[model samples]
Target: METDGGERSISGSSYKRQDEKFKSVRRVFRIMDLVSERGEDLTAKQLAREIGTNLSSCYYLLGLLVDEGYIERVSQGGGYRIGPALPSLHQGKPRSDFDARIEPAVKELAHRTQRHAYAAVLWDGEVVVTQVKSPPRSPPVGVVKGFHGASHALALGKVLLASQGAEFVDGYIDDYGLEAFTPRTIVRPAELHAQLNKVRMVGVGADFEEFARNLCCVAAPIYSASGKVEGAIGLSTTTRRIRDEGQRMTSTVQRAAAEASTLLSDEPDIKDGKNRKSG
Candidate 1:
């Protein structure tokens, strides 16, 4: 009887440890899922809150995941995103079919404008350039695929941020403070808010040497079928060129963005309060 009781106690203890180990594994995967879904937007504290764990435990898990290349820190921010290894775990192409379909429009824009054309999307809390098309022999405009940050100073980024409404913009400002890239950059939140209102009304956004001196850009929002802003398309060129042809450039960008929106009419609706009411 004594031997049987001892065996039962040992078995119960082992089972409890195994259950705890399974819970830990589950938490790790949950972290991965959140990082993948949010794209470089979740801080350690946010992840801890979402996963119902202590901050120390969350940091430990995040460290292990970073070491394993399942998630990585953002280049310019305090958040984590899905890492290279996560994609290699699956045997599928990295770029989506939608991205492939959108390239032709960007190419056409570049050809028409004879400048650098690009498309960007608001991936959770980051503005990521998804495609770039440049005219043959055109010089680099500093925008590239996977380019992100400095939304406060970029035309495409402005279009996306304006579409998300004032509340979302406030949260964005809170998360990533507006860093002035140039003298023309809108450093004041109130001023930026006013400019975004104009963007919402005019259906276009512009950067006049805000991101870089002697460079200018114009962009228009691309809407999904449900009327949510999903992305933006824009062109970048010298400031003098834009000054000489701002109206024409704006029109061309708006037309191309509208066409892309039609092509993406069936896209899934954005989640997490996209296009929430303005303040």
Candidate 2:
């Protein structure tokens, strides 16, 4: 009898542990579903309330998702969004060929400008650097591939953000709270909105030491065949260099972005010809 009772006790404990684990897994999925439905508008506190869990547990789950690239925060103290890895899992493909086409343009831009040039895209509600090229003997500009967050402080980021419209920008500012990276960073909603309006009007975005002291950048939008803003290409250099040659560099970057856009528009024709040859 004693042996049988001990066996039953252990079995009951094992079942309880399994039930708890299942509940935790369900909570994770629920969180993902909420973020997907809301689209970069669900903060951690809101998620905790919706999931019927404590804030600590919600944060722990959010941390796990972020570390695994299943979800990402829009910015520090901001809401959540679906991340790059989740869609890749569904499609089982590499980075888009459009990004591949942008790489050569970035390289040429770097050579022409003698500065660090990069391409960025709005991926899953985040500004993601897709490619970067640095001219020989150029100083480090402190950006690289896969760099994200702080979109309001970057020229590339502003181009992408401005394309998304005022409502989205308002939601972003409400959720992300405009972190001031430098004294020049636009921390006020009205000022940021005005700057974004100018970006829309001028077809260019410039960051004058807004992200970091002594660093400057300028970007232009890259359009898709559908006439949608798909990405941006930009050049980064010293503040003095930007002040001295801003107009020239701006034109160079805009021309490079236009060329990249043309290449992207031609990609489908190129792919169709290849398919015909294969057939």
- Residue-level lDDT of model 2, residues 56-99, one tens digit each, is 99999999998987787775448877765564444334335666
Global lDDT of each model? 0.79, 0.79
**Model 2 accuracy (lDDT, Cα):** 0.79
* TM match of model 1 to true structure: 0.65
TM-scores, all models, native as reference? 0.65, 0.65
Q: Which lDDT tens digits does candidate 1 get at residues 223-244?
A: 7778878678998888778778
Model 1, runs deviating above 4 Å: 1-95, 266-279
* True-structure RMSD, every candidate: 8.2, 10.0
List the candidate 2 regions with Cα displacement exceeding 4 Å.
Answer: 1-95, 267-279
lDDT at residue 11 of model 2 (Cα atoms): 72
